[model samples]
Target: MDSEPPAAGIDVSKPHPARRYDYWLGGKNNFPADRASADVVAEAFPTIRLAALENRSFLRRAVDYLAEAGVRQFLDIGTGLPTAGNVHEIAQSIAPESRVVYVDNDPIVLLHARELLDSSPEGATAYLDADVRDPADILRKLDESRMLDLDRPVALMLVAIMHFITDDASPYELVRTLCDALPSGSYLVMSHATSDHMSAEELADTNAANQRSGVPFRLRTTEEFARFFTGLDLVSPGVGSVMAWRPGEWRPHPRPEAVAMLGAVARIP
Candidate 1:
């Protein structure tokens, strides 16, 4: 990805969650530091690679569902490095006029996303250099930029991104704040990394490696993850392993390996 003006407060030396995630997904947007950490985690547990791929599939299916549901606007927080299929592309394909605003603190993601991830003329795609911890900043930028219409129904795509947040940060409240901003019929889609489906040894190795890399993993119980959607109405199938929730003919056989990731899509009341 081509370099651009750096977004403030970006640290390249320490591995970031987005960059590490890019590494796990077989993307080159990550640095060697991230790859080293991802390699260690992958070695400790082989499913890590497949989990990333499955997470992508889950994202696609969720976005498609929202698009088909008549939601035309999207706000994708914790936007990672741009990959093959992105939220804007997927949603806009279903509805050409879909407007999407992707927010991320990573300068690398901001730089690459702006330059290469072009959007349809009728629709709109923009990037915000904001962190998920501060929903106010995100809302302020979105309002000032006018990239998304807060008055209309929107799809809030938070897939595989909230695990980076710890309890002190009040991830549940943050999600509520963002979801509350949308009008009724809006959607909140998320995929969280957890140890619910992993063996004790695998969880230990994965958590240890992540902690060593300075990004600790907190694998929440399904109930804990479900709490993020407290005020929303869960779609059918509720929260499940990404593979089990609307798998959609992607695999010939289903393997019940405990996926560290749990996914769900819900509608805001």
Candidate 2:
């Protein structure tokens, strides 16, 4: 853990999803506005906190699996505010030579990433202030910066962020472009929010509240979310709830409430 440094572009007025997510995960790097909005969302959908925790756990498992499968590079986009067991930490723990490039549109997340997302001596980490909708810009910046070798296998992580991109944003095309750019052995790890686990009234309430909060969360169906990985080969267990995807020894078991997000890992072959 790093020191409690000041955050950059920490807007206290408008509510940002990354900051609100940080607040939900029990981190202190969020503004009052973020906390208020997160509280409202959580109140509407009480299992939101569980969803965040499960999503984080899924990230750890996915990175570990990728690193063990010889993936030494990682590109984590829409990375929310830093918390325990981040991408670099998980990858480097399995293989110290892992390299990670984190991208996020949130300036506050970029600031925290620079301060807290430290890398091992044998590895490297960099932050890009960019949006997920601009895959070309991300690839260009990555090339110009020479942070990670594109020819090598890299894990593309888009955990719990796609719901923020509505159909109008062309999220599928963005994901396809990035996946197409990667080599055969590269991986795509994703966890997306869905209404599959919630009742009609619950889903309606969640949608209405999100509209009011300005987060624009678009919950997808299991099949709809799977479409993002069009040509990729899904890993073992295929597309399923985050809690059920390769969950090792974690006690108490995963209930439907905590596993609201669908998780999947696919290879570009």
Candidate 3:
């Protein structure tokens, strides 16, 4: 983690989803406000840290699967604070020529963008300090990166980020805009916080905690989450719990209800 002070535009007093997620992942780059929000949510959903870890594991396997599938270009949106086993690392490990463009709006993530910039000599990496709501701007920045080719089969990764976008924001449309720009063979890999696995009491407590947390969050149902993959060719085991999405056979699988997070990968036809 960078030892520097917070970026000028960052509001440390207000909790951001990225920082709250980092706290859950046991990363040190978080503020007191983030920890407070995370703890409040944890009180309702005791396995949130486990869910975070599971989601991250899902990301690693997704990237590995894509890389092995010959998808060398990646557009990772809502990229949180860079940690071990990032998109580029996993992809490039399988194919050194992989190219990645990571997008995130967090000021702290911008400050630490250098970690994402380190790329294999045969590949390239670029970080964009942009919001997911602005799909045009994100595509423009990807063009500027000069690494990812829209005509190629790019993997659009939205891991554990869409819950921050409220329903009125048209989250599905945002996804469509990005996918529409990609070629036929492109893929969309996403995991979102879901209420489908929660007990009634737990759901109530989680909703209350999120309302009080100051950061807007929407826990979608499996049906709602599945809407994001509409008209796309869903990879096998489509729209299931993140904990079991193509998890290798080496270890026993955890029950999906334990994480309460949904994940899926779909190819744009």
- Ordered list by TM-score, greatest first: 3, 2, 1
The parts of candidate 1 lying over 4 Å away from their true place are 1-10, 115-117, 199-201
* Candidate 2 structure quality by residue, lDDT tens digits, 1-269: 22254455455678888888888788877776777788888878887888888889999999998998899999999888888898899889999999999999887786667654588999999988888888999999888879888888889999988999999998899899999888889999999998897789988998988888767779999999999988899999999899889998868865766658899999999
lDDT of each: 0.82, 0.86, 0.91
Q: What local lDDT does model 2 show for residue 171?
A: 87
Candidate 1 structure lDDT: 0.82
Reference-based lDDT, residue 51, model 1: 80
RMSD of every candidate to native, in Å, equals: 2.6, 2.3, 1.6
Better of 1 and 3 by TM-score: 3
Query: For this target, which candidate reaches the highest lDDT against the unseen true structure?
Result: 3
The 10 consecutive residues of candidate 1 with the worst lDDT sum are 1-10
Q: Model 3: which ten-residue window has the lowest total lDDT? A: 1-10
Cα lDDT over the full model 2 = 0.86
Over the stretch 86-159, how does candidate 3's per-residue lDDT look in tens digits? Answer: 99999999999999998999989988899999999999999987999999999888787677877779999999
* Ranking of models by lDDT: 3, 2, 1
Per TM-score, the best of the predicted structures is 3
